[model samples]
Target: MRSFLLLSGLFCSLLSFAQTDTLPVFPETPPLLEDVLQDAEEEVDFDFDTYYEPLEALREHPLDLNRADREQLQEIRLLNDLQIEAFLEYRATAGPLLALYELQVIPGFDLPTIRRLLPYVSLRSSLDDFHVPLPRMLSAGKNELYLRWSRTLESSRGFLLAGDTSVSGRFLGDPNKWYTRFKHSYENRLSYGFTAEKDAGEEFFRGSNPQGFDFYSAHLFARNLSRTVKAVALGDFTASFGQGLILYSGFGYGKSAATMEVKRSGRVLRPFTSVNEASFYRGAAATLAFGPLEATVLGSYRRRDGNVVVSTDTTETQDLPAITLSSILNSGLHRTPAEIADEGAFHQLTFGGCLRYSSDRFAFGLNGVLDRLDQPISRTPQPYNRFYFNGNQLWNGSLDYTYRLKNLLFFGETAVDPNGRLATLNGLLAGLDRKVDVSLLQRWYSHEFQSLNGFPFAETNGVNNEAGVYLGAEIRPASRWRLNAYYDLYRHPWLRFRTDAPSRGRDWLVRLTYYQKRKLEVYLQVRRESKEQNATDYFGPLDRLVAHQTLQARL
Candidate 1:
């Protein structure tokens, strides 16, 4: 166990520079993204797809700092809400920034923050004419294509099996996974890309999916036109707004070394090309801006694979057939006949829209979404399942806002389901001084609160049957030394998959890092978490419930 934790920490630390080669001028990805994804992968597992479309897009199309608003500034990830507010205020009163180095004078920006942000941001005059001619946009665009394949040496059972056509037989293809992408862009104003991937256990050219790959995605996005259209997407894309209580299609960092990583930031419409097979819009989405106000509308039709059972016993009594599902099976693996049988068994339609208004220090947004399924959903019999969405059609609408006061930035969202069950998430991000920063998030999702596609910042996976509080801080006492820590206390009001009764849990992480120069860094991290789960019978005299404890340190 000691060696396992030590090796786990080293493995993650070594992956820090992995994304540098993905683009022409890709700098070593800031460690903030690497650590955030590592924790998110451990939390949600398969949902943490290593999609680089957005980051690559940003690097190729750097944000012009002088013209960027609160939303555009937030996309930098290195800028917290407090820093964003300060940046806009500085530009408003002092006029356009004379140089990029002016960031050193910003209230909340530290040296490390400035270094991390320099790659994706630029300082340009407001009248620099950021627009591109349509002919040059199409004729002078840059294009890149990438193909990658990977496999494991020690394989799972699906890789080696006796030759048989039975349902229990091995996977149709080898254990190797395949990925390929093609992208075209012109200074971030115009972009079109195609991405495709096959999971490890899925077939290559046989069985249910005869195509070369199990998944394929294509998108074309153009932004910043004359004055009417802010953006447009012909195909697949993702959207995130406010603090992500209503719609956060893009993945944001959770708990990480950067204490203020709590804020979620991305354009309203972004190209989506992750390995996660669900939760993305497939048809069309667009954003239109008119001065201080902006509007967005989107609609999608996609097929998802899940096991579904129609109950005949209740069919005669109701107009719709009762459906039950064990899980959504997000692994994207189709090895055996049982797995293949679940492919595209359920069809769905998702449509939503958002209206946003932005001022110098305040922003307000309204978002609404509707999800319809060909088959109704019924979860396994559990206390937590009582409030889960049941009907084939579901809808959620929310109002989200952000307001700034001095060094503190306050943000929150209030959402409701079709029946009025409510979910609320509120947070505060403040820069105590030049050397310290802190963040607080409190979430309350009613027992019956649900949104089929709503993903918020919380301890649980989604906004349903869970409530929690999170607090985090980052301290820099010197130019080269920094400390980060956070504590999360949460409770599941109803039973979950592994636990038989309601439970409470807590998690905490602390990390220290030192840098001699921008080129050299050394870091140490310690983490501990406690949660309740079903216990084994090995420990005599104990109840069926056990508190799972984990402690790890990396130096």
Candidate 2:
């Protein structure tokens, strides 16, 4: 009965709070690394950059500081958001916190964010999800097994037509590129695993993968459960709300050197152990809590591998000839025969939901998503895709926010596309003193903003025809001297892909360091960028239109 009237209105709002008020015990978020999902696969065009399975699941699950949260303290990108709200307002006005030298008297806690939370937080004590024992959480905690294999020592004519048994340019498989993983965890409540991969000219267990790793993933994550179902997932998952537009299947990091890490922290639901086969979302997702309102729900059905385009125009009452989908084969490589005839052709069904309301410094969220596709998406006729997105369905809606006062802080997200186009992202992180810090960001996507799982916080890498402005800074002044910088200015009005007009860009970064106290360190860095392209199609005599500049160095 509607989850029993939402658990009897969450037990009458937990009997109107005050059962000696207590809440804010979070921890159990580990599994992220590839320099942290490499800026959302930097506009994916990969040739290779392995993501060692979430750094072996954070080297076997780590992240616990009086149970962390704030998206696991913003994935230790080295505290921002005013030093994670001065270490949670100094552990909620003094209580629980014994050493780490009481964060040298909080207030924008520094010392390089306590030396990056001393290798993933601790000061333990916060493990009691009441009588855990799923066979002692599966024989007391951790277990891992991973394997990798690769090939490509030059020999591609489809691996020489797979040993040439004729069939010109053959290649129905075999070139070796396999990976396997198995994980098991406990102490964050529990997690299950499985992952397998193969893609080096596909074919593994024979012709077009006769069931033998052509990509496979599995998962089971649980947390708190009966404590008001605070988390749950079964079989591949990922979800992100806010600052990511509608649904954001995690992956981030941009303009690095940890300058406020350009916000977009996740964990509205997680566990999709990356192998990036068209960015996770296999099935089921959940999170529920009513003490400060939090409710997340998700559903997914996968089968996405592209290429199925047909359109010769004619359909005003069947005369056949109108099937679409041209583009979307996210390199899950399927070894030639025209990429094994487009692998899993296309079938995606997603439905997501979120509604949040956090406390202690405010927060709010409302996200929605819907995507259905089973052959229908015609593209090929451009002027920068004249407002893309065709048939087979797409829907998105969002409204996100966060706030703080006292050394200031704020965050934002706004999305819409019921075919009315819109996208927005906002930020500010100030704390200018106690050494210094500053950050500000603004984004406005909308060249017909569309999202089939957004990734907001951009400079192109997919978040839709850009519009940007960002500024950042950090300075230590002493105490092992430090400095950081950032700058971004962008525009991409339309035409993309080998650009041909409507473009503008700029990027800058600087880092300088010199630490000592955990055994010396030194650093120096620089970067530069500029864009607006499409040059050298070999035409000079009075030719025109071109621009480029890229540079980076360190010492």
Candidate 3:
């Protein structure tokens, strides 16, 4: 036991010595805190002037073709204001310049000036180079392509319930949908493909078609036009006319059919309201721009076929021809010689108007024929007048002013027999006349028509008096931000057809949006609506409120 203890002590001593030998050996030295502090102080006093002076001098020096605003570019050696303005304007409309050589494209920016400016100008910054190359190359032969996809969910509720039926009971609605777009471009031209949409909501209304996968739009065009005019032609397409006054054929308005159902004593009481097929118009259209004066003319034909009753009822077919013309005139005071030379902007008081005419088959009006074959019916073809106007005609005119202060824009219009609530007209004729036929109007009606037409029944005509004013102002405080807003008021002379009674309402909408970067955006909106009537036993008070928040990104 004694011998073993001696051996253990020797082994412990050997381990300690080995551990000590493994450690690093160094000379003893004092801390250098003083030296470090001195070095930091020297750095604090170093001359930033060496870096800032060059930048200041560069800023003070006027830029030539590549790095200058209109005025500064004009001051450079041989260039004039007109040439400078033209160059800057072109650049502004085009985009961030990619190379100094592009300056030669500007009028009066000759090769010599471009060469002189090259040393002082840079097409890219260090940060810009760090990002992915723009006009991203997609393939060796094909131009770069960009694709985007988005999804949204929305819910809405309305204020009034007209009957004890399901649609009249609660106004709860939800829609979930997705969208995808693909685009490819070369030079000044582009080609695009789009689709991707879905609908999920209550059965009473048709949500958007799952399209599930329908090609919504596929087209190719040159966005930048040749010298005097701009134009586009479509092979097969959809379009809108003058705020949709005459024709508006697009997808998804009536994806869901509005319906009403009632049940009593555990038995189905009433069948669903008639399900009207969604409307789609196939056509081609274009706009012509001579200058400040522009015009758009469109013509389209549509057909709708559907059953009035169950599978046994015979189908009804209808055809419609729609046409519209819109024109704008502007004074030529500030126009360039090219504008005046081109005979585009004429020197005259500014005015404009639009005319839209549609044959009867164009719109979806209420069908009076009942599905029961044995029932008695009136045979007057339900007064089939394609043009249902409470007043005289279907023409609209407006007077406009373009002032020098930021080229302020002011316009007002009045329409004769404004077709729907969408039309805006000007003048004393814009008021509603109580004696006019209240039965032919489609959108908003006075209480008299509602009572006369009966609950849950759809009618075309109503009170036609509608007048409103629109004023707009746009100001950009920064390069990446803008603001705009508008207000509208509408009035009906008769409240529920009470002679000498009037009801009025107002709608307000405001929006603000910000472009945080080239591909990112954020926006906020507020909307409010109010009606002039108090609650009646038949219908609730009329009022509505809505608010929206949105963020969008593109890549």
Tell me, what's the RMSD of every candidate? 5.6, 22.3, 27.4
User: What are the per-residue Cα lDDT tens digits for candidate 1 across 172-249?
Assistant: 777777777776666567777788888777878886667778889898877876687888888888877666665777
- Order of candidate numbers by lDDT, starting with the best: 1, 2, 3
Report the error of model 1 at residue 52, Å.
4.8
CA lDDT of 388 in candidate 1? 75
Candidate 3: residue 437 lDDT (0-100): 9
Worst ten-residue run, lDDT, model 2?
4-13
Whole-model lDDT, candidate 3?
A: 0.27
For model 2, residues 1-555, the per-residue Cα lDDT tens digits are 111111111101111111222221222322123223332324543322122333223433456566676766764455656788877777777877777678867766656557645655667676556566566665555555556665666666767767666664667776667676666666456668787888767778867677887888989887765667878898898888887776776566666666676777656887776688887788898998888998988999988888887777886797888767876777677777776677788889998898899898888888889999988877787777767677788888888988987677888888898877888889888877778888889898888777767877787766788888999888888878778888888889888876766888898878788878668667787878888787877476643447688877766
List the candidate 2 regions with Cα displacement exceeding 4 Å: 1-98, 102-109, 112-127, 130-231, 234-248, 256-282, 285-299, 302-318, 326-373, 376-378, 381-477, 485-507, 511-528, 532-545, 548-555
- Which stretches in model 1 have alpha-carbon errors above 4 Å? 1-25, 41-62, 126-135, 162-169, 310-327, 538-543
The TM-score measured for candidate 3 stands at 0.33
User: Comparing 1 and 3 by TM-score, which wins?
Assistant: 1
lDDT of each: 0.74, 0.71, 0.27
Ten contiguous residues minimizing lDDT sum, candidate 3: 255-264
